[model samples]
Target: MSSEFPTPGLKRKARKGGPDVPMWAARADLVKRGYEPKTVRLPYRLDEPDDAPLLSAACLRLQAEMLEWSSGHLRDPNRFDGTIRSLSRRYQTDPESPFNRRLKHTTREKDAHVLTLIEKAFGDRLVPSLKLADFWRWYDAAKKPKATGQPERVRRAWGIMKKLRELFAYGVAAELDGCARVRDILAEIRFPQPARRRVTLDLEHIEAFIPKAIEMGRISLALATAIQFDAVMRQKDVVGEWEPIPEGEALTGIVLNGRRWVNGLTWAGVVLDGVTRKATTKTGAMIAHDFSLCPHVQQVAAHVLPERRVGPLIVDEQQGRPYAGDAFQREWRKVARAAGIPDHIWNMDARAGAITEAEDAGADLDAIRATAAHTDAKTTARYSRGAVGKSRTVAELRLAHRAVKNSA
Candidate 1:
């Protein structure tokens, strides 16, 4: 409602019913008034009112400084400098100000990557005026025909496009009635194909594999597999020295050491206690529990030779070095093949098998949920649903028989 700034002589007139202008428009307005765009302090208010009040001169100065700081660190520093210089001159003010020091620290690399991919895919047509359907068509064409190989690359590209849409929406939300257009584009963007489910290994296959690994003189591999089978740990979890708990003897749940071993899990390595840090569980905050080593797991742990004060529970024999994730996968695959299991058995299957085995052993839903660190019984049910069905059917059959007998 307040029109304090007048249209510059060089600036183009606003359309009779056209949408309100953007920050870029304000720069143009300044330029028309014989002021350089770079010199203008574009008004912007911080979300935190404690920092500065909205519409205040201090807020406007702080906003300009924040923009300058962001632009200075751009990969093409000159491009950002030029943009800022144009704005500063239009506003008849310097871009650099003391307020710039208070700007929040952020990395724009991911956003930059997204922008680059969008530009490459859609060229000049990547602007907000383009329809959402057009962007989807462009995205589909950019990805290869085949589903094989890394899907993450394709996913990342889609993510970039989504970010661009958000940027456009954020820019226009207050003034333009077209905010709905950007929202529609985001809602319509299709995600990449979901990852294929990994093959789960059954107990029979695991029983066959353990002996062969030991026979082949792969002591570490044998132990790792045994732990995977019995404890139902992910490949990452099984490879390292267990996280030390005050009550180690109680042996509750597996607590992974935060630090990765140098040679990885393949070679004997040390757990860097200095690097030990707490990580939030997917289900939110929960106490880290110590995993109890089963007899077979204990046997594997027993074979670990002490080199330093504290080290990895498993290591590579030949290199005496740690094994990386990829290397471990390759070697583990060989062991799986020799043991006569199908090639599809993957790391995740151990987790699935553990859930299945626990259900088969008559563990209740709550017990399974707690053991697996699942956020709720519903998720645990997904893993043990088959066992649950079987148990329910048996219970119903017994109840029916009891009812008939009582009537007799």
Candidate 2:
């Protein structure tokens, strides 16, 4: 109490003659200056050698805080206190969660499904303790509904695991304590990469498809199939709402901005001049195509144009609303069955067919790339089927000629 140097405001009476005491309090002037002077308290006796560093740290922090500086821990509580369940919950519901905000709606839906599977399998498992072997175990046992082979179900489960890898990667970037281990385990567990084998339609299939759809009284489906094949548009573009040009507006031709059309342009309301601007949803790339130049596109447009009134471009004749993507697929399968086309071929194959046709027509890589809105020219190659067969035929001819020359 009778010390040579005493804290400025620390009173002897307030001390109660005990080492355990409030070391500091905020001054009135500091509070008036918008500073919340913090009180530094020690858990143990202040004079104890073991608590000296702790008391010193608290005092330093209090001093720094009064001077408008940060001294306390700044670590995210979620990062330290998190488990797989907590992180998954935050990823789903927390607006501040980065992945929650960044993932697209369709992607978010898939992620939610994956999260459900993960929760069911490893919800209580600590993120750090998660092992690569555990993932393999889960993968081996995972099965989809009515699935016979392990490959198909494994592929589905593998997709969920990959999504979890991405989520854990985000956690690692955020400096979450256990996420690095989870991310690493996910990385080392190698699943078979499924080949991107798409059943691309041929020109003959398209010719047959249209007539059968017409016969089935699915006029919108028939015309939409034709447009999808010719314009290289996605089924979503065909069936989704098209933004029509505003009244008295001079803007003509279709302008797709993602799923929505711009400049009052709707798929049903597209005013075909000689060209149109199409923005693909997958790659978010823009490309120009001549809608009027193609006879197939024009013929389909002529057939559907009269029906494109003031609403959805591809509507149900009965409901007069846009066909849902699944609904359109169902109708397409019916037409394909009636047309004597393979049931394995999807409605989406028409777009692939269009890309193949463009490639077969001697369009350069970039030209076909633009038509398909492929971000990579190499990806445009995957959509091409006819060219491979043609190239093989030419190679066979060269081989024959080489044999002849060798004999001579």
Candidate 3:
């Protein structure tokens, strides 16, 4: 091959008996300098059609790269600049940064989405110069087209502010210009917290939902509801989770849709005598559940299809794969609707409902906390927010105490 037309950071090679056309390749020198997009292949033109526009996405990229390289800003992202965009890029790209190292994969994914928006909105804003008024304006921009009191708008605004807080803290840690003052300003400002969901998956709702789900031929939904309601487990625990398959290794784990699926309640977790043990994903606490404790668990266990008995306890019948986060919610919602479960009662409320039920049944607070796999009793108490049965029990106890006093 011979270079018919030579270009910096690109080249066009020619072969004998080949038409005189340009075939572009990124210069090997660019790779030596660690420039990204190591190779650039310009889009070829169609000969059958008349002369088409020569510009392409690859050409634009090359142009940008050349300009950046000439301007000595090619490695700017690698260095810390006192800009919001620089801080965000560091949080996103640095392998050892808290964003990538400390947070869960799911959490990092959500933060990454917010990071892109943050960069676009405040890319050039310097952290040290960020004021409360300016920050509020940025938040308003995020909540645009959604009015005050809208649940989604407030939730999204809160999420964006939370990410900004984290980034500012990171900037402070890195000793970037003006981040410390901004952090303190953010501390004094009151960001609207997302409203807590008050609707709970009540006992009556659960009872109705389970049989309806089973009758509708969604045994997995029934099993999941039973397990979650009885054991106070998160839906993620029942549906399991999927992890990515590592590169350059033999593919072994449950690889579905090109990702490794693992850790949602596998059949193997269910041991002899109806005792099931699994660790919580959020907290590393090990939970040993005796399915015999809840008759609902036993009922669902008896109805488990033979195939389901071999793999995960709740495999999606349609995909034959462990339920993903969104898919799991959708399927569960469908069965919930069919069961006449109210729209406000989310699948997540099942944990709270179970805790409330235990509290009403006179179960010890410590026991309920352990059942919910919460490290703190206070955390467990939050899940029982919508529980009215416990209040009724308390009212009854007070009346009985009054009666005893009168008799005395």
Candidate 4:
């Protein structure tokens, strides 16, 4: 074949083709040099003709290129095969697959953390051989013995396992197109049983701790005690802040009046600023309620100097900072010891005590739920058991009375 083409300076040159190349080969050569392929532009239409042949050819070319690359770069044949299998299973067609969407949902940090754990549990060499069984074995090893009273550790392990399982499922779905076998494998796994609900503190036990708090010269301890008794605020919330109620006046001398404290607002509520970053109640809710502050609480709040009013209501005088969760726990232990209460009467005990007291006081279920800010009624029901037991006693007495009358 011979071709005549104009050069940049408008000079024509006859170029001879080597060994009479085919038309298609020549066309490809032209395309390699940046010449556009000739095709008729179709008019806008709702239905388009199938381009399966062209698509198949393109895919074949891409597969060939990938194979060449993998042959050189991927030294491990097993890993390469696994990767190819995963890709095919996840997407019927890689170009339009949902793998990218799934990948986008996961963070690099989370993946790295999970991978580290997996690698540590199973040596690096065995990590590549990780199956669902390997994950379960790792989880079992991580769990503490049932007799250890380390239910929290077991729960943590379960959480980690669940997260890992989700990641695995996502990978299988996206990389293997969808792995029903993996899903079936995960379905058989069961989490460890959670700890039973143990109400560790009673009203009497908490009341005993107040004197010790007062004796320790911990001003905020008195407030915390009062809040725990009155509002069902968790330990974290009770100690977080002591905001002044709008148009509120501070409680004055305690001895002068039988009432321990009086606030401008009907209820001495904590002002919860949603924007602030801090630990919240387990339910992630805040409460503002009217409850009578204890006489000791009134006394302590009044005594604080004007300069120390900022930050959390509870403060460490030495640190000149608000007492954190750990600090509060430590103080609580000390207070419990001084009050002649068992060490089990920790901060959470106060919350449980409040719930028990409220139910005993004949507060309806709705009222208790509102105070606790529980998302589910089931949680509120847990606290209402004490109240239910008391009610059942009354009902049993009435039933016995009727039975005696009938026998007579």
Candidate 5:
């Protein structure tokens, strides 16, 4: 362990013939005790403002696991058997469980976080003795205003309750005792729903974002932004998604970073009519767009040599493969910051911006609905957040009608 660093309990090993800098890893005791990860290599030195928090988080997580292990919560079969913590493990590991087989990798990662919160909340509370009030109590506690003067995290608490409901359903299916009662109780209660998002990404943002992404050599990100804006597509449809590989199966798609990546828009999807046609991942409804009409998509497409247009439309030039997962958004945000886009707007907001722009341009709701492959116009209505622009469009149309009548 090094005394030079502020973070203690990390072991160091000198490189054989590599850099003079030593490789830092978790302490030997944590390794000996068999942490679930078994590997906690720190690539970051505590140099930047962000690095300190990252290192501190690893330390806190390691310490928490160690505390749980020593307190008999993890080690004692008699005290910990059939607890929420144990059930969560089964939910994660069972081959037939939705967590293992059915969930998207991104979803699994998110649920795993919620499950950790659930484990801490319930502790040794046996599923057989659980009550609905327990959940409500957790919800109430979760919604309390923070000491930092922050408002109650109602949305966050709502999400936790939603995941808890799913866990209860799993419990009932698995025949964990008392979950049926709590599940019934949950059915009687209504959870809160947050209002639709109002923030939007517009053309000015697109003009700024694309050129910066291109300058930074993140052409894939640039193209994805353009496609997402022009085509009104989800990031998943544009950049593809990562999924867990089945135990025994061969996939034709790119398999990197230990997951199978599939379903991104391929250059093959770009047809001779200059229209890019592909089925969306979520709704499975096909969307087609003429890239020739979108200058941003057209300009970025020129950067990719015609000879290199054979595979996934968006490839990470740095890795020489498609982005692993969520890395696209991470890199997109970096470009956004450098390009002077506001933090209030997100990469996901690109779709909303496009749709709002369409509404202002007087495009029909049904037409905009097809942009997202949405089944209903009313649903698309919620995402069209530009009231001022839409109002102006309406005003212009009314005055134009009056002028035409006068001329006639």
Candidate 6:
């Protein structure tokens, strides 16, 4: 019987094909030792010195596997034990997972909610076993109204469908089987009809709204409303915290400790003669507006500055911490209710008012875009609330009449 020891002959044959090239051949001694003699090819050049070590390592792995097989301990590493629940958990909690790592905090939070809903529906199902029909069934269930009976809007249904696609697409990226064609198969889904929002707030609503928020001790909300009202900042930006600088400087396109400044006034940046040197944040566009120029906004900001010395510019009064997105919404709801403001006047509509104010003040599209921190002039137009459109129509008509008179 051959000894259960190193096979010198097998090691020698590792380079027999010439100078460390990959070679795999059956050995009689290996077979006689109650093991399968198999060939393994590696992706290393024959001339490389590392190739011999890698080849020997492969041979050793095969021997170990054979020994394990004899001892009934061999296991498949690529086994399909992954299920929807497991994948969702991994995506939701595994810090190393791409879904957790790559997404923003708010985005990850939203994804977690979506994953929870998905798990409640199909958590037990294996990821690789999900078919297009199965996906459609789940999607149909998702679109059904909850106990509240509020009809799920087309936009929201579409968002859920997209997230479902993302789930399967995640599986495919992780090399799971059934997800190979998941996105392509799900592409057959029909888009939900868009619901246009027509509930716009004008200057009067804001003028009536701010005092009520202040009266209810929603100081942060009041300050946020004021900023949004005057500056046209987004709710996210208005509610977002700022990293305080003693010098009042803001650096654009710079991230400090994973945080980016979004909306706030700074007294620093390119000071020139007779020019209002403006600072920019991610939410603030390239051109800066002097908030001091707006006395009403200045008054509101001054009311909040002493208490806003640290942490977020706007904070929860009860917790003394920054308000999470939903907390802010709930707080706003109470404030609006107390103020006798209609439920349909969203906090965001203040931005539309600000944009309209900019238009009413005869500021051009470029000025409004900068003031609103908008990336596109067309987007500024959308929020301009017919102000710019009305002006444009009048100007066009007057020009046409002048041309006709001159020609006559």
**Candidate 2 per-residue lDDT over residues 295-336, each given as its tens digit:** 665655556545455655566776555653367777778888
- Score candidate 1 by TM-score against the native: 0.51
Model 4 Cα lDDT, one tens digit per residue, 1-408? 112211111111223962221111113343364432111111111121243343333334334434444355532222212222322223322433443344422243444465455435432221123457766776777676756654446765675676556544655644442244555566688877556556646667755666567677766676676666656666656555222232354554221122331211111233322221223434456555543334434545566666655644665555555553367678767777777887654667666777777777767768788777777768877755355545866898999999999999
Off by over 4 Å in 2: 1-82, 96-98, 143-145, 149-151, 241-269, 305-308, 389-408
Estimate, for each residue in 1-408, the C-alpha lDDT of model 3 and write its tens digit: 113222344445454897444333445675576654444333354242332333233344455665577467765564555567778888777776789779987788889999988877766554544677987887776666565655457778888899888987887777777778888898888877778766678789889988888888888888888889988999887787786666786778678765777768877777535778888988989998888887777777778755657877787889887776588889888888988887888988889888888887878889989888999999888888755666787899999999999999
Candidate 6's TM-score: 0.62
Clashes of 2: 5
Candidate 6 local lDDT, residue 80 = 31
Please provide, for model 6 over 190-283, each residue's C-alpha lDDT reduced to its tens digit, 9 standing for 90 to 100: 6564465555667677667678777777777887777677667677655653342334455544244444544433223211122333334453
Q: What is the lDDT of residue 30 in candidate 6?
A: 53
C-alpha TM-scores of all predictions = 0.51, 0.68, 0.78, 0.54, 0.71, 0.62
Give the alpha-carbon lDDT of every model: 0.50, 0.64, 0.74, 0.49, 0.75, 0.61
Worst 10 residues of 3 by lDDT: 1-10
lDDT tens digits by residue: candidate 5, 1-408: 223324544555556885333123444675586743333445455445566665565555555655676555664322224356666776777677778778867789999998888777664455545565777788888777876787777877888888877877887887776668777888777867556689998899999999999899998999999988988889889898887787788765788755887888888877523877888887788888877788778888888888988888888887888888667778888999999998889999999999888888878788889867999888899889964666887788999999999999
Please give the distance, in angstroms, between residue 275's alpha carbon in candidate 4 and its true position after superposition.
Answer: 22
> Can you write out model 1's per-residue Cα lDDT over 1-408, one digit (the tens) per residue?
123432222122334685322232234443464432322222232233432332344324434544444455322221222222221121222123211222211123344455555544443231234566666766666555456664435655466555555544443432333445665666766667435443456678767777787777777787777766665454555464322344435544333343224211322222222121122223233323233435555555555555532445566666564564367778878888888878767645776777777887777768777766677788766665345545766898999999999999
Error of 1 at 36 (Å): 26
Candidate 6 deviant stretches above 4 angstroms: 1-82, 93-97, 127-132, 153-155, 193-196, 241-287, 301-312, 315-321, 356-362, 377-395, 398-407
Candidate number with the higher TM-score (4 or 5): 5
Q: Which candidate number maximizes lDDT?
A: 5
Ranking by TM-score: 3, 5, 2, 6, 4, 1
Evaluate model 5: give its TM-score.
0.71
